[model samples]
Target: MVSRKTLAGAVAVVGLLVSAQGANALSIKEALAATYQNNPTLNASRAQLRATDEGVPQALAGWRPTITASGRYGYSWENQRGTYFEHANYAASISVTQPLFRGFRTVNSTRQAESIVRAQREDLRVAEQNALFQAATSYMDVIRDTALVSLRRSDLKFQEEQVRASKDRFNVGEGTRTDVSQAESGRARAQSALNTSLANLNTSRAIFRQVIGIDPKNLSARTNVTSLLPKTVSSAISIGQEEHPSIQSSLFMVDAAQFAVKTAQGVLLPSADLLGEASLTDSNATGNLGPESRSATIYGRVTIPIYQSGSEYSAVRQAKEDLGRTEILVDVSRDSIRAQAISSWGQLNASIASITAAEAQVAAARLALEGVIEEQRVGQRTTLDVLDTQSDLVDARVTLVTAQRDRVVAAYQVLSSIGRLDYDNLGLSGARYDPTEHYRLVRDKWIGLRTPDGR
Candidate 1:
């Protein structure tokens, strides 16, 4: 069974490609920038971070005063001492209830919300890295497949030339009927290979559009991420454990869980609030002969929780358990990041070695193909010998192309594993999405119906 990472690394029958660089060439960095700005998944993650930012303000609301205004107008009929009277009454009131103390629930909840928002930022980082990685892969795939198609088409043309030459030689009694048959057979196989390569190229192009959200045009395969990576595998693993978004997010979750436990316990403690109210009422109690009344008062009250239900205790205990779970998950995330970093490091090393060997192999295969063709021309080698050598050359060149693409992809994998594959590291100068900008705008907002973007 192929390893998951290696499955897509090598094309079954690939070919060599010469990269072109033009002023308008779409570099991998530009592709990544496009993906960062246009990928739906990355954009959704950013939106989710903004939603999490709202949690901070929601938590802060617990510390703010609750103000309300109410008014009522109605008619009532009453009979007393054999006399009946109907009166219209109206009342309007405004009240404010400010929490003088909430047993530290507001403080703990606010801290928890802040922690959660931090975790969400890390989550957005993860999503960004994932989107960029996939975009890079799609870009490389299209290049590799396109090269294969070009090589196969050239091969088909060579086979066609060989078929005509063999038939002419057989007609002149310089070659046997077997030579013509073999040439024709090779031509047929080349046609089939060309067809397959064309299909693969189309598939790659479709995937490229799906991931990058743009049709590829003069895309340059220039994703070199090794410079952003650490020097050694051990160092990479260490850095990944420390800086990987998953690990950081998990750590924040642990902190948030701890604060959540505290918030839960706060519910079991005493609470205090200050209430102020002003009201004006007009009543006709004496058959439309009554004066309007207005009153205003301010009062403070505190209540000690004796016992309402056992649910609060249950909630506190559950929160403590959740905190423990989050703490353990921090270690889990660290281990996972370490493993990924080490694996990516090994892949990068392998890709570098493969590129060197593949280049040498392609050169040797091309020389061998030339020698075989000369031998066949002098009647020292069979026509099949020349065809087989050509096939070998094609395979060697294909391997080289695949190796080059793999090298770029492996470097990205290594950079991403250590959490360094980001817009800043990639040198993308496009408009940056700042999650903290939204967070800062909303954190201390006391009143707002619209979002930071006026949505």
Candidate 2:
């Protein structure tokens, strides 16, 4: 029977192991959604987008009539015949000022605000797309490292078997000391590879945690290799140009700049304003019985841009220059999108080819290793030959795993280039964690994109 202390120790050990497992168990989809929802960088960008929603109200200000109220109170006193009297007067009035015209400035400014709002939305989209790309890349990296670790472990097992075989053969005088030494060296190298792979896996997991706010040690789902290759580069580029968030955001900016130019030009024209005011006042002096007064004013004012030290002209010119710059930037963005799509498309295909070749190489290496082992058994191959072949097999497996992971990641990269790597395209549908849900909840409220409970 176990003592109480031993039972307690065993329970503690089990608890620790369970805690460790829980800490590492995160799936790729979970990580992706968590990062998209909770990542500070992405959330900050969402807030920025919501902040931009205020532009509409600001622009609407130009088109709305403004009302203001004013009030004043005063007390006056004068001494006469050694007697004193005091009086107080209060007046209040409300006025409305309507801008009838401003060289279309109000209209143009409103349009500029609309363009800016659209641009900000595109900016948010770009941010989301980039975050998804980074999260996906890190997820694949961890998977690749994990695969390498498995490969190293298998190699070590194979080498250990070889060492056992060599020991038995040497005991029977059928193998030399060199055979045993070679097997030992092979096992050591395998152990080193295993250690390297483990370290790399840890590093990848750390980055994954940093990005998605979760450790992914339990994310063991295999990537579907069959779905990794795209059908055509032209199709990819076309989709990317149409949907890529960066290009879309840049295009929106170009439109906004165009509107700004119009608004600036409108500043060179005449403007009309309607102003009115009314006031009531009362005053009493020590000698006088009492005093009272009233006043009122109403007028329509039209101001034409006579001159402004060339500042208005300079603004118009500067806006035109800005429009020109934005037009060029749009073209530049188009070219950049095309280049990225094409480059990633090419890499996707290259990775596919490399994976196929690596698979073939792995098969050939395994066969060669087996042949070298047989030759060593028959005294036709040196111990080093067997060890070298074993090393080649390990390298072949490593290359295959790398190629496969790259191919899978490249597929996503291609999708990312085309801006199609979103939840819908990826089929992350149904009651899944929706990052945009939070944005929608507070979008119409004055507080904007934040929960009432202040998450």
Candidate 3:
């Protein structure tokens, strides 16, 4: 049987091969995974999640036994009627205390901390999704730019062919000076378009490289345009609402606030605990004596609060208010997520339609340009008309390429909104790097608590 580490390494190699073909080739999924693992913003969110984990221990401290130790030394001398005496004393003791009652403060506090941890975990998830979504968008842009460059180069070839034909016709005295001028102008414009497209392609590739942690300059690949859009808007909305990280994170916030109220209630309740201590002491002086003996005392304490000048009451009320406010926030988040789902769904559909329309436009423009060129050869079309048709063809091609790229990006955005833009969904081929992993490792040691999920 293959070991897990070996399998992971193999998968990583395969992933590299998948994105390293042709010129400036990279898959959107691979780029997303790289961004998810390395983006600074996502890493920061992971840190915040670990910080929230400390709340657990802070709350637990209220319930655990408290121990304290102290030591003291004293020296004294007296002289009277030609007699002098000196004495010294030393004492050390340890004390232990356990809370017997506190208005349910410990219980409420622990629960509140748990809720906050949950909220922060969801927040981490949301951040990861956003990072991956950004990477996907940038990846699609690079692909589109690369394709448009190729298209522009092909158009330039056609322009060169037209120029050659115009020259041959002029040599036979069958074409006018204006016809040659028109062909030459068309060729020049096509070259300019190709140069611009190449520049845009390079910029887009650089952005993808920064996002995916891999250079995408020598790989050229095309995507299937028809598969860019989802089949149903209703399904997209439903899925997005269920998986969207922001909404889930907000839901956890409500849980945390409610727990805060519970913690406040704990402040007024009774609690139970056991405590023990040890001590040693020595004294060289005693009352009216020349010598003294050492002694030690150890004790435990139980504290019960009856009044606090209304501070406890205010704390409880404030906690309740916070809980109520968070509940409202949850409601607001739900509405906002629903609205976002609907909006993203519509935009995805519109982008898909635009892509189709743009493709049709490119095809029509190409045909029109060809027809005008033929008419120019026959002295039936003006030089300006031929030039205009060539420009239209180039613009249409570029527009179609951009529209297709946008459709792909929009599809990924819809998935991200639903909270599904995770490593598994992206189909990354290596060990998933969770930025929270290190934080989780140290959370227990730093906070003195068990994992909330018991993992």
* TM-score per candidate: 0.91, 0.81, 0.77
TM-score pick, better of 1 and 3: 1
Q: What tens digits encode model 3's per-residue C-alpha lDDT throughout 92-119?
A: 7777877655567776677777777777
Candidate 1 residues 1-455, lDDT tens each?
11222212232334334455567988888899899889988888998999899999999999899999999999888898999878789999999999988989999999999999999999999999999999988988888888888778777777787888788888888899999899999999999998998999899999888888999888777555667878899899888888889999999999999999999999989999999999999878654676799999999999999887899999999999999999999988888888898888888788789888987887787677767776777789888997898788778767787887888888898888988888988898679988899999999999879987888
Candidate 1 Cα errors over 4 Å, as ranges: 1-18, 79-83, 285-287
Error of 3 at 310 (Å): 3.3
For model 2, how does the per-residue alpha-carbon lDDT over 316-356 read when each residue is reduced to its tens digit? 89988988888888778778878988988888778879877
Ranking by TM-score: 1, 2, 3
User: Top lDDT: which candidate number?
Assistant: 1
Give the CA lDDT, 0 to 100, for residue 61 in model 2: 72
Give each model's whole-structure lDDT: 0.85, 0.72, 0.67
Better of 1 and 2 by TM-score: 1
Clashing pairs in 2: none
* Clash count list over all predictions: 0, 0, 30
Looking at candidate 3, the ten consecutive residues that score lowest on lDDT are 9-18
